[model samples]
Target: MSNSQQSLGDYGIDIESNPESQDRQDPHTIGILGSADDYAPHSIDREGLPNINGFDWEVQPVQYGPAEILEYWRLDGDFHDGLSHEKIPGSGGIIIRGADDYLREHALTEIEVPDYYTRFENEETHCRWSADGRTHISWRFLKRAVRLSNGYGRIDPVTTRVILCDTGHLFVSGPRGAFLVDIPPGRIFRNGDDLPEPPDSVYETIRGIQVPEENPELRTAFERYFRLLSESPYPSPISHAGFNGADHVLETTSEKTVVNDNNLKVLGGQTKPFEDTVGVYSRQCESTNFVVSVDPMHLPGEIGEEVTLSDDITSFGSSGDTTGIITGYRTNWREEDHIAPSSSGVSTLHFNLIVGLIMPDLTVTRRRINVATFEP
Candidate 1:
C-alpha cells in the first residue's frame, strides 16, 4: 500500500476497493483535482499574535476577588504561601486585606508577653495588649471583600515587635499607634489569720461614777439644778425679800453717885450728891425679821404677805402702825421637793431691812441689810 493509503488506518477510516461500495459509503467524497489551481488552501496570517503586524503582546489588566486581592497586595511571589483576607459572612460591604503585613509592622512582640498570659490570634481588625501591659496594637484593611465568608479569612500567625513605655498599664500597638487599656482589678485570696489587729492606742475605756441608789430623788434634783444653772446666763438668787427692824439705844453712867457725901460727913454739913449721865439714851429703834414656813394648805396670799413683810403684828393695832417700809422681797419654792415628798420640803424666804438709828450726836443713820430664812 502507498504511504497515503496506509495512513488511512491512522485516521480511523478504510477505503473500499469496490467502486460501488465507495460510492454508497462515501457519498460526501470530493474527486481529486486534475491541477493545483483547481484546489487552493486558506491563508495563515499572524495579525493576532505578539510582535505581529507591529502589535505589542502583553498581559491584560484584570479584577480580582477578595482572596486574590489579598494575594496581590501581599507582594509574595508564591500566591498560596502568604496570609490571605476575606469578608465576614453577611458583613454587607466590609472587607479586610493585607492584615499580615500590618500586624508584622505594628503588633506587639510575643516575647514581650509572659507565657502565663494568652496571646490572641492575629486576625484582621483585632487587637491585643502585651503581657507586660504597655504596648497596644491592632490591624484592619479598608478594601471590601469580593467573596463572602464567615469570620476572618485564613491567616497565618505573624511575629511582631513593639517598643512600649513602662507605664505599668495595659496597652496595645497597631497601625494607628499604641493606646492605653483600662484593665479591671483582679480578685486576690487571703487567709483569716493574715488580717491585722488594730493598735491598742486606738481603743479607749470609759469609767462612769457610781451614784448611790438610796437617794435617787435627791440626785435627780441636784442634777436638774446643776443643769439649769449651767444653762442660765445669770442664775436667780435662791431667796430675796424686804423687811424693817427696830434699832436699840446704848447708854453710859458715872460709877460714883453719892461718894462725896460720905467724905464730908465730919464737916457737919451735907455734901452735894454727884449724879452724872454721860449721854442721853433716846434713839429710834427699827427691827426686821424673816420667817419661812411650809404648809400644805398654804395660800398664795399668805406667801405673798410673808415675803412682803406685810403680815400683821400684835403690837401693830388694827389701824396698823408702820414702823419701817420694805424695799424689795423674793420667794422661791422647791417644786421638786413638793412633787417628791421624800425630798426636803423646804421653802426659802429672804428679807432686806432698812433701819434708822440715832447716834450719840443725835444724827439719824440709816442701814440696809438682807436676811434669808428656810422652813419646812
Candidate 2:
C-alpha cells in the first residue's frame, strides 16, 4: 500500500461512505464530505514542539484523516485539501473523527493532567477571586478514546491532551494543532433572587417543547418556567436558565457554600506537606464571608486552636496582613474535598482540602494537580 493508503487504513478510521456503515448510521452522518480525492498524503513531523507554560508537551501528529474530517473535529478549516498542512496542531493521539465514532467506542482512559499549571482569573471574563482571598481556577479531566469504524467497530484508548482554561477556553490537541473547543457563550446571572421574565409571545407555555406526559404536574411547573423563559430577551434561554437555576439553588439552600471541583481548595496552610498542591493567591473581599471546613490532619494546630495567619502559615506569601485569626475549625471534609496527581505511574497520593483563614489581605489557595476521571 502507498503511504497515503497506509496512513488511512492504519488507524482503522474510514471517511468514505461505506455501504454497511451508511446503512447502520443512516440517520446520523459523521460530517465527512467529499471522497478520497479530498485527501492527500500528509506526513506529520513531531519534532521541536515548544514548551507551553514551562512544560514540554509531547504532542502526537494527526494520524492522517481526510481534510473534511477536521471540520467534524471542530477544527477551524474547510474541506479543502489545499489548505495549509504545515500548521496543523499535533493531535497528541489518534483522532476520533465524529460523534458516531465517539458512540462506537468502548472505553476511555483517564486523562493524565499536567501538575504545573494554573487557572487564574481573566479580568475581562470572570471574577478576580473567590469569597476567600485565594484565586479559584475551574478545571476538570476527561477520558480519551477512539473507535475503529471499518474494523469490527472496536473501541480503543487514545490520548487527547484536553486542557480547560480559567477564561472559559478549552484547548484540545487533535487532528489539527491545539484548537479551541467551541462552547456556547453564556451571560452571568449574579443575583439568584431575581430572575428575569421571558419576552411576550402568543404561544402556550412551552407549547412546542417536549416534556414527559407522565408527570403532568411537574410538567406544568416546567411549562410555567419555560413560559418565563420564552418571554425573556436572552438568546440562549436554556443556558441562561441553567445559570439562573444554579443561582436559585444557592439562594434557597441553607448550604450557601458552593463547593465543587472548580472552587474546592486544599488550604494545607503550609504548602511543603503536599507535593500535589500548588500555592496561589486567592482574593478575599470584605463583603464576602470566608469560611472553610478544616481537615485537622492537614493542619499544624488543633481543631480549636486559633492561629494567626501571618505568623503561623507560609502558604500565603508574606505580602498580606497576617494578623487575622482562624478559629472554630470544623472537620467537615467530604469525598470530593481531596485531589490527586494526573501524570502517569505516580503513586496516587490523595490530598484533602484543609481549613484556613480568609485573611484581611492575603488569602492563600492551593489546588489539586491531578485530573479527575472522565464522566462521559
Candidate 3:
C-alpha cells in the first residue's frame, strides 16, 4: 500500500520498452501513475472468469490539479486536413472536468467556431464527410483528465479521449457519458455524494424529456436530481400504470437505442465525475443544448400507440402563477436545424411547461421526457 509512485507515459499507460529489465518483470501487469499509497488495489472478482490478460486493471487516483490544454488540432473539412496545435479561430473542443470549483476555475473557457463552419448548418459542418465522402477522417486524439469529488472533499480525477456520436448527439463515451446534462462544464459526482441541486451552472437537463407521471420509480429517481412539485400543472410522460394500463407512456422502441433511452436510467441518480470536451469548460448553450435529437417517427410505447391527451398541448401553459409542468419538447426547426431534409418533418410541438414550475428556493429542471411524434 505504501509503494512509491511509478512512472507512466503521458496517458498513464507504461511505455517502458526494456524487455530484459525489471520494468517489464510483470509482463501482464499495468501500472497507474500515482502514489500507490493513495488508493487501495481494486481487485476484480474473477472467480468464474478466465484469465484473459493475466491481470486486472487497477484503480489509481491521480493527483488533483488545475486543468491544462496541452494541444489543439484543426479538424478541417472532414478532418483529413492534418494536425496542428496552432490556434485557429472558430474551432474548439469540449471541456469535461470535475464539478469542483477549483477544477472549474482552471479549465479552459469557450472558443468560437470558425465562421465557415458556423455559417454552415451544424449538421453539415459537424460531420466527417470530406470531398469524396468516402475517406476516413483523421483525428489526433489526446487523453484528458476529468476531476471527481466526493462532495465531502476527497478528489479523484481520471482521463479519457473517447467520444460517442449517437444519431446526432455527442457523448463522452464509456462510463463518463452516463449522467450528462447540458450544464456548462458538466459536473460529475462520486456515488452517494449529495449531488448539487440545479439552476446553478451545473444542472440543466436534456431539453425535451419530462418526468413520467405514473412512474413512481422514475419520478422518484428524477426528483433525486431535480425539484418537482406535486401540484405542478405540466404533464409527465407516463411510463407504466398499475391495473388500468396507461397509453403512450414513454417507453423505448428498441433495446438497442443508445443515448436518449439509456440516459433515462442514471443509476441512483449518480454520475461519474468528468467533463466532455478538451479545454477549460464553457457552456456553449447553443451547441450543448442543441445536440440532443429525439426521434419523432418511432416514438417509444408498448406497441404502435400515439400519446393520449384530452387537452391540446402548447409549448407551455399555466395552471397557476407558482406551479405548472414543463415538457422537454422544442421547435424541431430551430435556425440551426438545417442539416438534413428529413429533420424538417420531425416533431417540435410540445409545451415548455417551465414557465409555471416556479418554486421559491428550488430551481425547476426541464427533465428530458420523450413525447409522441406530433403531426401537423
* Greater-TM-score candidate between 2 and 3: 2
Q: Which stretches of candidate 1 lie over 4 Å from their true place?
A: 1-165, 175-177, 190-376
Q: Residue 182 of model 1: what lDDT?
A: 26
TM-score of each: 0.12, 0.23, 0.19
Error of 2 at 323 (Å): 10
Task: Assess candidate 3 and give its lDDT.
Answer: 0.22
Best by lDDT: 2
**Per-residue lDDT of 165-239 in model 3, one digit per residue for the tens?**
111111221121211111112112122111111111211132234422222233344443232323333233322
- Between candidates 2 and 3, name the one with more favorable lDDT: 2
lDDT of 2 by residue, 168-222 (tens): 2233442223333222233232343112221121012344553211112233433
Better of 1 and 2 by TM-score: 2
What's the true lDDT of residue 149 in model 2?
Answer: 11
lDDT (C-alpha, whole model) for all candidates: 0.21, 0.26, 0.22
lDDT of candidate 2? 0.26
Per-residue alpha-carbon lDDT of model 1 for 212-294, expressed as tens digits?
A: 11112222322332232233332211311110110111121211111011111111121111111111222121232334443
Candidate 1 yields a Cα-based lDDT of 0.21
